[model samples]
Target chain A: MKQDQDEFYVGYQPKAPAGIAGAVRGTVVLLLLLGAVAAFLIVREQKDIAAALFEFGVVREFEGVIAAKPYPMLRVARPDAAGDAEAFSRYLLVAPFKFGADPIVAPFDGKKVSLKGTLIYRDNKTMIELAAEDALREIGGGVGDKPVSFGEVTLKGEIVDSKCFLGVMNPGELKTHKACAVRCISGGIPPVLVVRDGEGTVKTFLLVDRNQGQVNQAVLPMVAEPVAVTGELVRLDDWWMLKADPESYKLL
Target chain B: MSLAYQAVGWNRQKKVYDGWLAVGILLYLAVFMVLGAVLFPSITAETLLIRGFGTASFVLLHVILYIGPAARLFPRLLPLLYNRRHMGVSMFVLGLAHGVLALIQYHVGGDQFPLVSLLTSNGDYASVVNFPFQLLGFLALGILFLMAATSHDFWLANLTAPVWKALHMLVYVAYALLVAHVALGYLQNHAAPVTTALLGLGVLGLFGLHAAAALREGATDKEAEADNGWVYVARVDEILENRARMICAAGERIAVFKYEGKVSAVSNVCQHQNGPLGEGKIVDGCITCPWHGYQYRPKDGASPPPFTEKIPTFRAKVTEGKIYVDPKPLPPGTEVEPALIQGEGVA
Candidate 1:
């Protein structure tokens, strides 16, 4: 067992120049430690800019009937004595839109329902994002039967998700957050279009199919990207709805 | 080569190599961050770090892959090969930073665990255009982690050289995955033609270098053989005393040594780590492996005694002032008499 190990050092016993491996390892360890410290120091807890932006939008609840077509919309009865269907102010109910019909809103169509969620207000625009479909509860009988008004318009903007844009991810929309935006939309987060006017003021819209159903897969590739979309614009509460034919939206 | 491990055997050259390597990596990262800030002022700091370090590490990985074939093409490049493990570990660090920053910026907001959200958030795997590109990057990073964590001689000794070398080969797999990660993720949104072109050119360059090196080696292995199954290698005067002249006969690399006026031949592949035995010389009358200082008897291809390592031997003869090696090789450790030349006194 104690045989000469030198026998294994056959022919040429090349002793290294003597300082290479150690210096290399020491340098490597030092660099790694420095990098870790720098990374830790540079990256701190980020401020919740999204929350501050959300504070600009006021929150409220509505008792209405759900528009369970291409996407979910709520037709709220006017608090005043206007009894006809025209007396209703329709508001689109936005939630994290997943694949297929939503389990909560799909069953409560044409029935009086109560929507309890945060209603965001910006530039005289109102939009509410539901934490879950359970926010839509049947309230015994149906409410608004008025014809849902629609107007055709062309809009330019970037498609983003309400969850991240409102408060979760700071400065969330752009080329960098594109993949995250795509994931949020695909995972059933309702997509919102942040359109900027000539005055640099911003307005947001919920993007859906022409019939206002889930457009998660249809616009999945276009998330967080700027584009021009021609769609039927509808007014629901303070929320602006863009029911575009999925094929009509073009990347800019 | 020592009987006991002492953590590491240090040398001045190794220290110098590591110092320069560290300086190069830090300088690269610093330049990247500075340039990013100046060029894209509106981008957030986190985004800059993620993209800057991500691209830097990707480029470094390509350079690491290019070093091997480059060294074969030019012996002067061997110094780069000596410190490559340091380069790899540095790359892993840069890559880990990019991955961590990306996770914090994108996936940490939701109620779901960030990793879980990354995997399940996008189920559009069926569409090529919408494939989960992040998954490719995630898997590649995992491979880099494995290679980095085990990148020491201690691991090499425990796992054995062949297995350790094989495990490190997964870098190629990681490279392929990273290519897809960039193509499908950033390029899709940014539409930068120049970046795409550069990626294509880097891949082509690596391919060209490897193919050229392989072709050269193949030519050496195809030299014509003599009628008696002996292949002509070199003239007796061409082999330096105490050194060797390497030859390829019947596809086997043989190192023929000339020492004390006698010639002996053994397989060039060292049993320790497949090091180039031909590059080593006869020291104290024993053949030594230059890589880790392993030694053996030139006559029988065997370790002196109590050591079990052995290599195959070949019959070498000198006729007409030239050295010739038999195409057939003998079993490992088989003893053979040394061949004597005319000018040299009978051995």
Candidate 2:
């Protein structure tokens, strides 16, 4: 085919304009210098962010739990006068209770214990969720009810019934699945306990919250033993919720 | 034929462009190393230097690739096209710095050997949601390094143009790999949406321009083919004073210049990589390619500086107020300088 000789030509040549090579070299040098400076700044910035987060009390400390148990009702009372009396409360309509290894057990009528956890405020109220270590410690022993700071107040309570849930039909009989039911519930939701007043009247209480990939083993064989559960005390409606410290929990 | 038409053949290079390229790259590395050492004391200065250099190099490579296409679309951008290899090599150095630093950071930091860590660190390779894209970047960089290392004419001649071109095409693959690297590694880790978008837009913009050019070429191919052969159909006003527009005939584009009242015809494609000379400007008594600034004297088509390629020139004559170009090509490098007419010539 005849190639056009009157058409526009566009092609690439390896050579550059006079002095442009020098200019490009200079520009690259400048950019490299600038990049080094920027990289240093970025590294410093990351360190600062990490430090700031640490200063803000975001890093949690492991503290022992004083006490724990599952109660029929939970509540969080407002601290101020203007705050609602019943801000957060969850009442268990049915109690499917179980003891140590038993499949079924009776509901926690009246019990009391102190537990410890990291208290976090949400919607203007405190909520406590126990960590694994704290739950285990609380099951071993119970604690006394002392006016503890938001950080170290371990709720102490007796496991009125380890398995506490509504009655469910078994294949053979209508036998209560109490003890084993609590162990099977998982999520540190076993070793159910009841917090009670001086007159033995059931008051607010705490329960175990488990993490993923963990199973609730048999309750501390030392039943009725006092345990210190350090975590956050979350006050709901009629009863207060205690989340045990996953790290800081010990059998007293 | 004109002097410009005869100059479109390959000429041996007096000086290699690679020397300037190497020098520029080394300077960038030195500057990066010194600055990094001074600025970052906590981390090993070498690592920072390498990373900084690599990033800058990639950016420079991108800029170099853009200059050619930019000059084509915008004639004024020709100046940027000059000394592009130096720019490319400098970029290569920077990219090398990045690769070396990344290897040190990812591989050396861990307890395992650097190479082992690079290959076996699959901790973050769980899902597409969090795929380890760095491995892909590493692979792409390896390809770029290979191409950059062999970017000299010596290698080009040995490898042959087709092989060289094919090897260089890995640039597109590198671009894609880099995109994935940034998206999965940096963006995911930093969660910086704005930065991600900006980088994405810059790369996408370059690709978009190339795609647009390809579409335009396809659309104009038929007209170009018709204009390539003997008969040149042009508007009366299209032929400017002393300068001529290239017309496509029979699938070829040819430049027709009217100098001193005489019209001459030559292949519009530059002998050096078929650069379009018709789009070039007549500067300082020479046809200057808008791409890479290669100058050729229009009298004999001889490239002036840093180039020695010659293209075929065709005979042309005006008949009955119409322009016609001969279908036959003159011998390669035939210095057929067309004479100029002194009297009032056909406008």
Candidate 3:
């Protein structure tokens, strides 16, 4: 059926036009202009902005206990907004840190520690400060009583109030039950263990979110074990969260 | 006789060439629009135009490549298959678009100097994998541009047909390079399976169709027959007016046709695929193949429009109530005056 249609017309070779070269040259010039504009727009969209962090500037050798459960949050604030108000306060519903201990006999609420981290100001009321894992160096203890500002320090502490919370457990059930038993122990919540740095002189954290299911799988078996975590120390309004990679801790 | 030859020279009044040029242009524009939507959205208008034009050129080459087979397979497709030189020129322009835009994107953007970057960026010249595929595309495009620039009849007449044909064959080389350019450079980075699959399917499909035609022709070659001055056969009545018939002649099938009150004899097979012209019909004063729609002027057996294939024609004459064919064939691309065959049995 298709071949029958091909028989109708005599094929002729068209003569090439004289001015075709000039027309093509003109078109190419136009095309170059189009490409340049498109490339510029794409590059612009991917650019990053820079801001200042003055108030939470440069704290030397600071340490503290895990005073509160550090829920990851994002705070966007204008530097010159009136009355130290935060422009954007959105909780990072999914915590990015993984935990490594069980709940039954691990550290409870008031763990102590001495650690170093950068203090980033996310506005006056809300500021998240943490010593990133890469910056965790073993600086020697302070000399004399001259109020040493060594810019960096390592935290020494005992495991305190640590229990795995809503993030680690299954979606609906936060209650102490057998269903949550996989993350928790026989009689306690999943370990959100907090270590006290030498008799509660400084407090720090050990909290894990649900997405770190692999770490939870590894840590749930070892309940009541004393461990030391090395990570970036972050401080946020009277609280500090250790942004530690799961590999940075050793169970003693 | 010279006046007659001049009168029979190419009929310029026919708008077949103009129609083909328009179709090619429209197809080029359509391809540009499609590539623009796919590759240039959210980009600056300048980049869009450059990339669009580049893609358009690639499509023009593709169109030129396919037109021959398309005309062979569908005679109605003949009108759309004219204007080879314009099509070539259009393809060259499009090639320029692709080459220049790519150069700006990968070379001249910032701190990198263009020439140094193309030559020395990825070690030595042997590693085409590491070598800038864009540069290869650039070179191929340059060749195409040069060819298009010289596609005039003046140049064609000056240069022998063989040299002209050899230069035109660079299109295939350019196409190969462009394919590599897309596969290695764009597909490697984008990693989109669908786009890769689509491109792969198109190239494979085109090649496969041509291959199928070639294979079919080869299979039928053994049964063809021939004789002196003409191939005397029982199926002479099968030749339709303005149409052709294939007669088996000494292990070769010869195309026999009648047009303008004249009988002409040429090889039965299409140059592209050895398609049986006997099964095809008369279309716009040409004998068209039924299998692929390749058309030939019955007077001279010259391929028309997009077809570049030429077959040896056997000088034919009707003598003493018998159709006789010459055992010797005129060289390919030969133009001969046709002789009329008489009798109601000669369909």
Give me the candidate number with maximum DockQ: 1
Tens digit of lDDT per residue, candidate 3, span A1-252?
A: 343322343333243232432333344344344334333332232211112132224544433332223332322223455564433332221211222212210232233334344333321222223333322232333211111122222343333212222212111111111122222322222233444444533243433432222234344433333456654554443334454444555665
TM-score of each: 0.67, 0.50, 0.48
Candidate closer to the true structure by lDDT (higher is better), 2 or 3:
2
Model 2: per-residue Cα lDDT over B23-62, one tens digit each: 5456545555555445443333343454557555655565
Residue B97's C-alpha lDDT in candidate 2?
66
Scored on chain A only, each candidate's TM-score is: 0.60, 0.31, 0.28
Q: lDDT per model, in order?
A: 0.69, 0.47, 0.46
Ranking by DockQ: 1, 3, 2
TM-score of chain A of 2: 0.31
Candidate 2 runs further than 4 Å off = A1-252, B1-51, B109-113, B123-127, B211-229, B233-237, B240-244, B281-308, B327-331, B334-347
- Using TM-score, give the best candidate's number: 1
lDDT per residue for candidate 2 within A1-252, as digits (tens), equals 222222232234334343444454565456455444443433332220110000112323322222223422222223453554543333231111111211111121222223333333222222333222322111222122332224436655543222222111110000111222322333233333444458845433344443211123433332233345555665434444455533444545
Q: How many pairs collide in each candidate, listed in order? A: 40, 138, 81
Task: Compare the candidates by lDDT and give the number of the best one.
Answer: 1
Which lDDT value does model 3 have at B96?
A: 72
Residue-wise C-alpha lDDT for candidate 1, range A1-252, written one tens digit per residue: 222211222211233322433433454565455444333322221221232223223445677777775456677666673534345555545554222224567788878878776654334434456644357667777744433457888999988875556543445676446667766676666688899889967788878787667787788777766789998887655566798877889988
Which is better, 1 or 3, measured by TM-score? 1
- Report interface Cα RMSD per prediction: 9.6, 18.5, 19.6
Report the lDDT tens digits of candidate 3 across residue range B14-75. 34444545554554455445444454343334344554565556555665776666544543
